[model samples]
Target: MIPWIELDSAAIPGETGTLRLKRRGDEFSIMLGANELMNSRLSGSEEALAELSCAKLAGRKAPVVLIGGLGMGFTLRAALAVLPGDARVVVAELVPAVVKWARGEMAAVFKGSLDDPRVEIHTGDVASLIEKSKSAFDAILLDVDNGPDGLTRASNDRLYDAGGLGRSGRALRLGGVLAVWSSGPDPRFTARMEKAGFATEVRTVRANAKRRGAKHVIWLGVGHR
Candidate 1:
């Protein structure tokens, strides 16, 4: 078995912990402290995030989507696959190094999703975008941190709170959807979405496409029409 090799490291802004990129042959992993945030080999839930969200906006013309976190670009790629050619995807990644890693070492993993004409990369907080934009996006896919609990950065907690959910709802068009990816389940988060006027549904998906890995959760919150 090939040992994991640390390719590079980057500090998480506003947090003491660092994100380390490691590779074991063709497989890649991104770790924050002791927690493995994402892996190239396990992207089923990430892809599902985009697929499920886009499903809600299927008939919308040139839908605008906001993706919170680039990760390995699984969500972005999946979104581009299902969305129409004119649909726009805005990806907000807080960590600049993560974006660099995606374009550099993890380029192959991303498979040129960054170069897509319809995709835009924002190296800033997704919350800011949500707060500023009113009824702008047709779908918002959030894969930031571990879940609503915030494992990478404490500030990410606001994105899952009631206020944040309100901002997200306001930022979305009528009948828009907010899809969130989590390492595990959080009933409280679902309730918070409901309180913010979103019809929510939680789905459990396999980490791997083969359906052999641990189950991850995705919450689909549909905005009021």
Candidate 2:
């Protein structure tokens, strides 16, 4: 068995914990403490997050999409694959190292999604971006933290709270969608989306493309017309 090689480490801005990038042969993983934040081998659910969201915006010309978090670029690449050629994708990632890893050691995993002509990378809090806009995006895809429960930063909880949901809704254009990825199901979160006036659907997806990995959850919240 090949031992995992630690590529690099970075301190999560608001948290004391450090994020480490490791690789075991072709597989790569981002770890926070002992928890695996994301793994290259398990991206089915992430891809689903993008696919389902883009599906809702089918036929919309020049759709503007915002993706929070750049984990291995799975969601970004998936979104790019399905969106119209003229669509624009803005990726907001809180950790600079994650972006660096994508361009550095994990370049192969990202497959040039970062360099795609339509992509714009923002190095800051996605929540701030959400708050700064008013009906600006056709879709906002969030894969930040583990889920609504959040593990990396305490402030991440705001991104899943009532105010956060409200801001997300306000940041989206009419008939827009907010797609979120989670490690597991959260009943409270589903209810929150409804309370925030989004027509919501929760989907259970496999972690692996082969369809035989731990189940993950994705919430698609359509903005109320």
Candidate 3:
């Protein structure tokens, strides 16, 4: 049996808790208290987050995409796989350490996706970027907090609120997509997406690629400008 090894820990910005990085053999996990925020082995849902959202931007030439959270680059790698070479992906990661871990200890997991010419790393709040933009993105994929119920930081709740969703709508180009990944479903979040003038679809995906694990939720919304 392999034992879990703690690789590193960093405090959550503007929050009291810390995020712990651990590894057991080839598997890695980012933990916030007792909850696992992300795991290297279970990347299906995260990959689906990008696949489903990028599919919405299929014919759009040179699309600009915004990805919130840099968990393990699963979504980023997935998006890069589907998007054309001219497309741009801007990833906003709230915690700087997460980014460090990505480029450092977790580089193998990321597979150099961060170095892709089409990818940009924003070491700040995703909300700030969305709030200040107007139709600047073709797609916005959020894997921020655990499904809207947010287990890491209290500020993450704002990203799922009505006002936040409104900003996201305005940040995206007409007919652009906004995809959110969650550990579970949130009915209110779905309702809010609709109220924000988006035609929403809810999807249940497996946590791992084998399609045999805990069911996770992904909400895809196409904004109507």
- Residue-wise C-alpha lDDT for candidate 3, range 59-132, written one tens digit per residue: 89999999999999999999999999999999999999999999999999999999999999999988899999
Candidate 3 at 175: error in angstroms? 0.4
Note the Cα lDDT for every prediction shown: 0.91, 0.93, 0.93
- C-alpha TM-scores of all predictions: 0.98, 0.98, 0.98
**Better-scoring candidate (lDDT), 1 or 2:** 2
Candidate that would win on lDDT: 2
Q: Least lDDT summed over 10 consecutive residues: which range in candidate 1? A: 145-154
Collision pairs in model 1: none
TM value for model 2: 0.98
Candidate 3 residue-wise lDDT at 112: 92
Model 3 residue runs over 4 Å out of place are: none
TM-score computed on alpha carbons, candidate 3: 0.98
lDDT of 2 by residue, 45-74 (tens): 999999999999998989999999988999
Across 1-225, the per-residue lDDT of candidate 1 in tens digits comes to 899999999988788989999999999999987889999999888988988889988888999999999899999999999999999999999899999998899999988889999999999988888899999999999998888867888888889998889999999999999989998898888899899999999999999878879999999999996
Backbone collision count in every prediction? 0, 0, 0
